[model samples]
Target: MESSAAKYCCDNINNHGSSSQSQTSTCMQKFRLYETRSNFYMIGRDKSRTYWRVLKIDRLDPSELNIREDSTTYTESECSELLRRIHEGNISTGGLRFVTICYGIVGFIKFLGPYYMLLITKRRQIGSIRGHNVYAVSKTEMIPVPNATVNSSIADSKDENRYKKLLCTVDLTKDFFFSYSYHVMLSLQKNLCNNEPGQFLYETMFVWNEFLTRGIRGHLQNTLWTVALVYGFFKQATLSVSGRDFKLTLIARRSRHYAGTR
Candidate 1:
């Protein structure tokens, strides 16, 4: 059943009012990670930081990604109070501690050991189109889901380290770019002409993190907590034609479907 808020949003859109625009406009862009002994709590906030939500990731399982999003929306004060209570309750067990701040989740990958969550820890604004900011990965982090004691033998294996090293060899900061509010994977024409929802677009070939985000997206039924990253090339430059200067931009999107095929 659609909640009153969702129904109101649809009604507002049907009337063509300015009350609600693209869903991307409301997607969470900033996140803070907190960790206890058995779980990782990720707090996400919107652009204004007015709306808040929490996602809980279980740390007890080394082989599976168990993610659950809290259904309640929270205000700044209420969220602080909730976190305070959580800390108080877990004080005897080395209470919740700040892990790291991240722009968005890259995805999760598993090796011979436990699953590692890839995160875009740092980003740089490379360019923009139609007022939407596009960012390139400046730095990334891969954190093991389970503690070291859980998978001691597998985590320290030579194959696991080799696989992890191979994954890190592909430099993400070079050509990859993503937008928080724009469908950077699709062309401008498709973006303007098509009215498809953001969640559907995420399943398309251009999004490199499609496979990685599938579990979380399926669990939450929304793409609000993840950013769709386009793996390809983006370049912007200035051109001079006869005495006039114009901005030129180029974007090349790699097709995941035909990537490894002959």
Candidate 2:
């Protein structure tokens, strides 16, 4: 069904009536809050190693939302148009629903609305942080969160210098680190107290940048709510009575002080 909100956008575009930005979103409430509320979409998966997704900010329409269930599948390029139209859309109706859905954001460098994001692609156990196994970044990928309208590769002759310079600054195979469920940043004492059954926070405020962490304060946070902090790729595993092709991802949550495996 065509939502009243989306319908209004088409109407407002045709009429060009002066409408307040807040009022426009209020009119879009039905479609925006439900279908387009998610921060990302699982576009597709291939074998066990490759996966794809599109940030919500890149989407053109809320009705296009496709969340892969155990039985669903997608292609890597399925959402490329969404990425392409990000720069093409007209905002005459009102402010566009764009947010860089990212977390664990580091670096002081800012590009307009979003900060550059780093994802750990490969990891190797280097040592222990307070008895917790800390893995070093063996591989990584740099992804610009917002629509930067520029290529990251040096292949573009016009942007070769600019892209090359930015690309040269990162070497993901070193220094970066991560541990799935371990609070490697905090000490064992504090972490132990954190997981004492009821004290663990659903959201960690400090991990978020000052701009976003403020509003989310004193509220329950979940991995789903902070999908931007997620690592490399999100895979969709689908299953059916006929057959199960989706690979199972096992996330083991251990108690404090008890180190878990990958």
What TM-score against the true fold does each predicted structure earn?
0.85, 0.33
> Residue 163 of candidate 1: its Cα lDDT?
97
Which lDDT values do the candidates have, in the order given?
Answer: 0.78, 0.32
Q: What is the C-alpha local distance difference test score of candidate 2?
A: 0.32
lDDT tens digits by residue: candidate 2, 1-262: 2234443333322243222222211110000111232122222222242333221222232222212111111244533444333323332333234332222222222332233334333456654444444454565444443333322332234454465467558664533344434554344578877643111332333222223322222121222122112122112244565575643322223232332343
Regions of model 2 farther than 4 Å from truth? 1-109, 112-115, 127-133, 145-172, 195-220, 223-262
For model 1, residues 1-262, the per-residue Cα lDDT tens digits are 2223322422322333121234334778899998877678888898898988777777777788877666666799977876776676566667778999999888778878788988889999888888788999999999998866566688879899999999999888877889988899898999888788767998889998898888777766678777788888898888999999987889988877776533
Worst 10 residues of 1 by lDDT: 12-21
- How far residue 80's Cα lies from its native spot in candidate 2, in Å, is 19
